[model samples]
Target: MRESQPRESGAQAILEKYDRESQFRLNLGKWGLIVTFLGVYLTVFHLYTGYFGVLPSQKQGAIHLGTALGLIFLLFPAKKGMQKHQKTVPWYDIILAFLAMYISYHKVIFLDSILQSRITGYHPFDMILSIVGILLVLEATRRTVGLPIVIVAGITILYTIFGKYIPTQLLSHPGFSIDRIATNLWYQESGVFGTPIQISSKFIFLFLFFGVMLVHTRIGAFFNDLAFSLTGRYTGGTAKAAVSASALQGMVSGSSVGNTVASGSFTIPMMKKAGFKPEFAAATEASASTGGQIMPPLMGAAAFIMMEYLGVDFSTIMLAALVPAMLYFTGIFIGTHFEAKKRGIVGLPKEALPNFKKLMLRNGYMLLPLIVIVGTIMIGFTPQRAAIIGIVSAYLISLIRKESRLSLKQTIYVLEEGARVALPVIAAVATAGIIAGVVSITGLGAKFATGIIALSGGILPFALMLTMVACIILGMGLPTTANYVVTATVAAPALINTFGLEPIAVHMFVFYFGIVADITPPVCLAAYAGAGIAKANPFRTGLNAVKLAIAAFIIPYIFIYDPILLLVDVTIPHFVLAVVTAFLGMLAVSSAMIGFFVSNSRIWERVLLMLGGLLMIHPEVYSNVAGFLLMAIVWLLQRNRKNGEVSQSAAV
Candidate 1:
């Protein structure tokens, strides 16, 4: 219960540190009213677009960016907790807000003429505002998403301007002029209004808004109760429940830290109270929550963007994500089971478990919207349409269930919350648009890919390793949308365009690594959030999280080499083989990491499990046999050890 509450200053501080949306807001009557109006205005704009139609991509993205800027300046202070006026907007932020709106309005009204003149080139007003607009995005992003992405975006812009001098042939470009760069970035759909922001504006925001609505219906409570009922009575039950509950919650929420904080509040405490160590308890929640972004249907907004990029449908992605998602959670489940076995931990008391049948009967309606989203996506509907219908279904079902019903005030609050929550993503995607634009204009993507491939001596495995390290480093301090867009823009091209990996496979490969950065060391925000709740060390929680999530690191490569794992180019036998090998590989790796099997594993068993996992995971028939044989050997060793203990116990 104490973990569930943010009363501890440490948790509050950690929340603010990792989650930009969790910062202190000045709760003034007048200020709240203005913020509410701004928030509702954004929600209405998106809802109207989602239902009727969206504006031109350029116009839509500009308006979206402008509204987000105004909200960020008002809601998030330039410095944390440094509001100059308690109940009033600071003069500078107000100026920036109006400037953002002014640029957006001009872009919409004069955009046609500006585009026509771009060849002949730039009116004085166009150039000035373009400069201002670019700066505004960087500053606003810094105020919202943090300095890492802004720094990355700035370096990209500077590279666009100065790339001709890079001397290295592979990395060099003839370079783009300031006016040319500014025009493309500000006006064209290829730049600040590119696919990334377009997806965020048109698709991702609807999902985020729907997510807030989903949360309001108390679906999270249903998930938590369901997890407890299913797993709370077994060994390591609470930790297993945490894994299930966090993964379920993460699937829709798409934010690793946000999901950790939300469900970790409930699951982390239960885990610690059930005799799990604080850091491991926190790590379990952190890793499982990170996996949610890769969960199908929503996949935390990246799936929709991938659909747009790959020119495929959401159904294809949902199908592809199925095996990987299952394996990811299964690995965590195995880790928790072994942890429980090693520590001799027992489950929560029977009284603590919810009555499964009654609970489902009473609350199952809350889950229908998820089904609606999945069904519609599979049954020939666009994802946007699917999301819209799903949201409406949720609303209708809520009216039928009084406990889940949204009062008029509650509805308004959710709307405001939805808009506020989406600001960080909106800013991140728009800035990513700048980077994407530069990549496009300079042909930097192809060149960068060439350099990386050449550096790896054209070896695919080596290239993948290089790409993974790049993703992890760049992914630090960046949100998922921005991280995915950057990697998809630059790194994905190397695999697909140059080296000829399957497009979807390469994209997914980049996405998985990018997402794992949230749980990797030094800048692991999700693990930091878990540490906050468990009162554990941040780096220690991150280390444990990486250990538990080893499957995420290894599975992408499995699907990449096999493709059968993703159900691509596979016979039924091959599909089944991939599934069996992948799961067994997961089992081996997890048991190796946890240092337990039939009982506590020996050093040899751990090494055997590690090698078996690597070999089995590679998808080669011979390697699978060798891997299986090695695992069987380890299994027999463990069995013999078990018999020796049993005989000794009997003799005693």
Candidate 2:
């Protein structure tokens, strides 16, 4: 009924303008200022640490607390409104911000010389600072992410405090003293400024900065232009373009829902104009956008976190991620192609499509930064150093074209923008650190693994199912990085302990599921964002996204079962076999979902095709042979039906 109300284009224009202005102000001031300072601060600290490593845990805690608090204040709004002169800062906000900074900055005051000389010890001032910092972090987390993560964090923290009173199996040693807890959380390396914070400060920020520099160099736009040139004249051109653009966007943006909203705004309308149903259009965009987080080069912040958590080289993780990432995009692209065929959608006119040579000539330089980044990292520079080099290269490359020039003001703007984007991620990592701290202190990770193993009867599939469910549930509320952190700590070890899966494979499995949650139902934010643009039912769009991304859900299991897909322990022949089988499996799954191969498939055909896909996914001689046979049957039947239909139509 509400949808029946007449809309005013002028009013909509005013609202859009208002929102843009408000967003700009928010980005430029609070979010921008804090992130810029944090970037500079962390860069300086890292440089100093690299030259002269400090062992002071309290000092480390202080730095973490300060950065976290700064992010909280800048990234989150005290309240939402449009009044230009309205005072957005509340009294409590000021109190908390100051407290967080004080606690972190004055960590030395809290420790005795012995504690300071050995492990960080409790000082009175440190106690006060820790309390304030913790409170601020909780409040800031509540404001930025949502009540769910804060509630989860609060419950976990509370459980830590009250473990002594719990049942035997769930309990821990009569837990830490309040002062000790504060000191550990606020001053120690195990707490606020631990691995998560270290990863965030050292790796995540540099990548975020790299993304900013890439954007300044017009690399993202070049990607869009390249996609347009490549796909703008194919059948269902807009949707194809959306897929290409989103893949490129995903490589840099690292936020699925954000990427969906960004590229979807353009591609969705174009799709609708090209005769796609609104819901299908939205689903296409959402599913494609969500796949971006799993894209190679950069996967949300999870890739960096994975490198830290696994203690593997960045290049190793990137190399391992390649096949799975390709499989993800391949599935989406195949699914979209089938859907286009089913609907008989047409592409853009030839006149509107960009000339390939001309487009490449203009934009080829835009790709140099990414090339340099991968090359430098492979040549053995630390990810941090490589990222800095990439950032510099991006800036330098921007100067080649007048349109992509990065002025001094724009450089500051990019820094500010990069910082703004990095804030929520910073908070998520810091909050996730609390979960990691709890697991480390209580050995709860091992306990949880034991429980999962017992429940799963040590069966690999059962354990994987349990892990996937946990990931989806957690990912419904948390960002990809936090989701990966929580699941990797809890479920990854369970698979390793129970199923004997490698640590890297187990972590990758959890990470994949966590990122897939963006398109999963109930709380599929990327799908919902797409629906908003398409004016389609959000639930329907989400369901469609799930269907479209079914391969992503299944492929992780395949990789876990047969690590060759992830390039683990493989001969050349085996690797080739795995690639061929996986490709066929994806094609089968896509065709089944779309119900169109050469023509419309019957119910039996669909079921058989799906079975073939499943068989193809599992690595075995018999299953692969059976899958190939079943696939051939479906193709022959579809071809026969299509030829018959054409003959009949010709007669008519």
Candidate 3:
């Protein structure tokens, strides 16, 4: 077994580095209460909206953005390290916070009146507000989501102005006046109040609030325990448990790093103890945790954005995601099993494993809320209604268990925490609105699609490759939610319009690659955090994570090639066929990648398996047959090798 150190820095250090949610509330007592009050207020506002639909879209968006922006300024420091030990709000931040409030309140004060005035042009006050709003949103985005998105948005704004000078007329615009640009971005429905922000305001917060409530009620722990009990007695149990546990946890939790730290702290050490290398252990946790974003039921807040973008119900996305997401986790599990076989590792001792039956009996109630949510949604309840009921039912279930029950104060904290956790998303979504607006106003989405199609020579495969690369690059520092919004806005149109691909397929395609960035090198935030906990080198861990998640990289292409994988335009027979071949493809790919199947694979065997998997993964019957034959050949060879070795041993 390779020697591995315990985490050098504790959870605090890992969180501060990777998670925006770990920021200090405040040092001053009064300021702390004030911040808490604001958080609670935001949560309540969303809850109120959910229960009783209040106000028009613009008004609701204004209230939501205003509240979130104010809290963001109050909570996140202007400078990073300054907030480490300091508690008091800086005077500048306080001013900025008030300015954010003023900006949010602008829609309330001016929007209806602007409409009533019948004036299409920007007044002086409107211009100032627009300029201030843009600057404040940029700074707030910098403080919350980091500089990548801010820089992107800033460049877009510059392009919106000076773009006409460029030779290309498609993306470039006739130079716009400052007043016109400000008026459009600030006041237009297409700007900060677009679908992204609108969805963020309406649905994302409610779901996140429910998720926080679910966590406070101990569903996360139940999930981890549940996974452990089910998988702990199997080969490579600890690592398998990580895959299972991360999938279970991800169904409810939205944040990748949060889930990584939450589950990795338990699974990574167990994997290391089971004799996995530190890099492999860390990478396994990262890959598994990052997968939660793609998992169903609660597949992060981005799914809500997709709901709006695709104009489909949540069930459609959930059903579509079911097969591919499972294949992703199964691939990881297979890799772990093979790695364990290669290392001569075994499952936990019977005495060390949790009792699966007892765990289910004791903690089964913890799943009631999820069941209620899933059932209600499937049975035709609105998602918000389902979530509200889930929260209520979950709270009631919590009352039955001492460990899971929440006190009144604790419940309030849950609400506050939920809203606090959503701040960065609010900022990202609103700022994403700016990008969407720019794309819409400048016709950049169409222009980019045309250019990419031209570059790709109108080939579907080439268009997909270009989109995948774009998603991976854009997703480097952004959250999955923001990553998808930006990618779909800029890149999805290329695949859909250029290749005449389905919207859902293109969206899912970009979404998968965007999320793969979390486990991809150089900026794999989830992988880095997992490595921090496993005390391994971050880059190597990220690479290993990429290897473990090979299925995610490949499965998207499968779904894109055959929308049957996405349950689009599908018959039952076709869906099953697509699913079976895809599953075999995953198995084949995992076998080749891990260099093991029925027994250890030889080099030529591995190559054969790879060839077969690629063929089967494509949706052609002849190719599938050819691929299966190649795999069957490899499997028989491996079996023969194992038999020969056994015979030699018997002769000895």
Q: What are the RMSD figures for all models against the true structure?
A: 2.6, 4.8, 3.7
Candidate 1, superposed: residue stretches over 4 Å from native: 1-11, 83-87
TM-score to native of every candidate shown: 0.96, 0.91, 0.96
Please give, for residues 1-652, the per-residue lDDT of candidate 2 as tens digits: 0112233453333223312211212333343444556645654554444335543644654574476576466435554433233334444555666666766666545446525633544557657766667767766666566566777777777777887877766445566666666656655567666777777766786787788778777676778878988988887788888888888888887877777776787789888888888888889888888888777787678888899888889898888888988888888788878888899987888788888899888778788888998998899988877887787788888888788887776665666566556666777777887777777777778888888888789777787898899999998888788888888877788788777888888888999889888888888878877888888898898888887788889888888878887778989999998889988988998889888887888999999999999899788879999998899999999898889999999999
State the lDDT of candidate 1 residue by residue for 32-119, as single tens digits.
6777888888988998898899998878887888888888877777886664245566777778878887887788888789778867
Candidate 2: where are CA atoms >4 Å away? 1-65, 79-88, 108-121, 168-173
Candidate 2: lDDT of 129? 61
Instruction: Looking at model 1, report the run of 10 residues with the lowest lDDT sum.
Output: 1-10
TM-score of 1: 0.96
Per-residue error for 277 in candidate 2, Å, reads 1.7
Clashes of 2: 2
lDDT of each model, Cα atoms only?
Answer: 0.86, 0.75, 0.83
Task: List the pairs of residues colliding in candidate 3.
Answer: 27-87
> What's the C-alpha lDDT at position 119 in model 3?
69
Which number leads on lDDT? 1
